[model samples]
Target: MKSLSIQEINTILNGELVGDTSQMIDGLEQLKNAQPNQMTFIGSIKYERLWDSSKASAAIVNENIRIEPGEGRAFIKVKNADLAMAKLLEEFDPGPPQFDIDIHPTAVIHETAKIGKGVKVGANSYVGKNVVLADGVVLYPNVSIFDDTTVGPQTVIWSGTVIRERTEIGAQCIFHTNVSIGADGFGYRPSDDGRGLVKIPQIGNVIIGNLVEIGSNSCVDRGKFSSTIIGDGCKIDNLVQIGHNSVMGRFCIMAGHSGLAGSVTLGDGVMIGGSASIKDHTVIESGAVVGAGSGVMNDVAAGKTVLGYPACDSREMLKQWVALRRLAKN
Candidate 1:
């Protein structure tokens, strides 16, 4: 654990300090959980009231909150407490997992594969024929990259991740444990003789842009033809499912359990809340926000906020909620 005096922390945050500046903080914890030697942060007004009850030696507070620290405790007031905390977390980060080795002896790489400089392939990882791994790529144990795939520079793929044939991944991306990329999309049609179903072959690949981060156990399916694309800086949470031929614009965020049906399109900066579902071929324009548990059946215009089971405008959903409450009171 690293310890820093209150003055040192304030210098790092570029914030105003109050109370005992010499006080030492060894760790950071939540308001209710901090020890006397630890610190906490009030990122917003909701957490300000906690100052009276918290026993922490110091706190990082948002300047807008206008609250004083308790008598004996110190406070570091910053422009945005959350962002300041994020910066401080970098100082305390434990760093990467203990892979350490450049390339483990147990890994298998096909002779046709092009491995770049500084690439690290862990034990039991497999790189198939015609694959291209760029410089600084790290493949954790048990990872599998199929034929004709290209992983860009500095990308890190965790254990049990499977990147299927012909996939294209961009630079500095992070794919967490058990991620499934470029698997065949869900497509089936009625048989000509009406016996059962005929499988529609998926011949397309998955293309992911730079700086994307996908959480554990998420799946991005391949397209029917061409590419299913994820643009730069998109962050996909755990258990999220992106379907065939779907195209996501830059910086889009999809929370845990959210799903997109085949051919769905998301414009830049779209935010999909947890468990939200967008139907096939639907268009969600730029800056739209879909609330948690929403079931979007049609197109959402730019900058709109929608929510609920059959998703509608956020204001309209609130009005419906009010009407239901009145009925229940009767």
Candidate 2:
């Protein structure tokens, strides 16, 4: 518990001190659990119930909120107390600073690999031959970048993520933990003997544009023949599956558990709800919304909202639901 006077804390957070400047605060804690040497913030009205029982030495509170100041307890009022507290917390509990030109000895980098200035490769990471990692890229521990892959500058890949052969990821992209990019697509062929199924070869790569964010545990399969592309500024949620050869346009939002089959094309600003599934070869236009648990089997026009299994217009689906309810009432 590092202690700082109220005046020092105010300086750190760039906030005004309205109470005792000499009061000491050891650390930050929640309203209910804050001790005599700790400070807490009233960020939400839902936490107002904790005010009466709080035992903290001081509290950072909004300027508009009124609270009775108890004996020996200080109240620091600020214009935006939540943000002030956030700044204070950041000052005290800062994350690890960005690494500059540091590569662990355990990391394997091919002699021919092109690593730009100030790149940081963590322990047990592998950079393949002819791979290009641009300036300011940070590869977390255990990351794998296969041969001929190129990652643009300032990309941060979390631990245990895999970037398979020839995949191209752009600048400022974030790959969360356990993400698998460019894995083989699910394809099968009929056996020559007509007795069983055989796996088809996946030869194409995945290309992710700048500023795209892929969540943890998500998988983007490699194309069976051509490239699978995800455009810039797309936000994909956790546990989503983007099948091989799919092309997602800029700023698309795909929620958790959503699945897009092979060869699907989504235009700019498409939004998909949780657990929705889009069939292969389907095209969804810009500004479209696919509702939760919906199954999209055909093309969706621009600026429309669809819902239900085998998705239809949201208004139609709601009408059908209301009719069903009326029948049940009768």
Candidate 3:
């Protein structure tokens, strides 16, 4: 077991220690489920009440919380318990999945493809003609990289992922399992004589910047003419759908199941909560926050927070909700 003593943990967190300094904590868990050999954190006031019944002999707590450790337990007091927990999790992370081969025998590499040093291509993966795989790039089992695509150094693409032609992926990006990049945009036009629908030929690619992380099963569609751009440090969550020609600025975060319709533009630091849907061609400015379950239909100003259907300003939505509740009771 990989264990850390109370004294060792306090040094790493630079926290003030309270009570016993000798307990060995082998794991970290939630308050409701912690074992005696594990540590837990009470990051929010909502969880503080549950701490009394927890079996943990050690805990990390906020400095503002003034409770002493009971009995033989220990507590490490820090500025923020949640932030401390994140650091601890990084310490315990075992690193990415490891495969033994540099390039598996079953992987198909085209004659014209250029693979860099230290690249690891797993079983049944396909690298098509004119593709470039940079140094330290990892393609897990069953990944498909189409012709003319270029992946930068240290990018890790998980199993079952697909990269379409002409796509450019920057350094240190992570594409989780089953992600689809540069697929055709959803575009259709009415045919002549109104007989049937005609497909719009999507000829564009996707450009992803460095340090981007896309969660499992998400899809980023190709543009109609140009590129669908995702800026550096963007984090897109599981099952998210980013439509054609959409441009996301640096450090933008989209939670699970959130979607951006065709050509949507998001400025730096925009936060999209889970299940929020932004309409086509809408622009969200920097630092704006869209609450969960909202359906946004228009532009959102910088640093503004929006909520509710046809998403309005958060303050306006609150007033409307209050008025509707009052009218309902009458």
Residue clash pairs of candidate 3? none
Measured by TM-score, how close is model 1 to the native structure? 0.97
- RMSD (Cα, Å) for all candidates, in order, is 1.2, 4.8, 1.2
Instruction: Mark the 10 consecutive residues where model 2 has the least summed lDDT.
Output: 14-23
- Show model 2 residue runs off by greater than 4 Å: 1-93, 96-101
lDDT of 1 by residue, 239-303 (tens): 99999999999999999999999999999999999999999999999999999999999999999
The alpha-carbon deviation from the true structure for residue 275 of candidate 3, after best TM-score superposition, in angstroms, is 0.9
For each candidate, what is the lDDT?
0.94, 0.90, 0.94
Which scores greater on TM-score, model 1 or model 2? 1
**Per-residue error (Å), model 2, residue 142:** 0.5
lDDT of 3 at 166: 98
In model 3, state the lDDT of residue 319. Answer: 100
Per-residue CA lDDT of model 2 for 215-287, tens digit only, reads 9999999999999999999999999999999999999999999999999999999999999999999999999
**Cα shift from native, residue 201, model 2 (Å):** 1.7
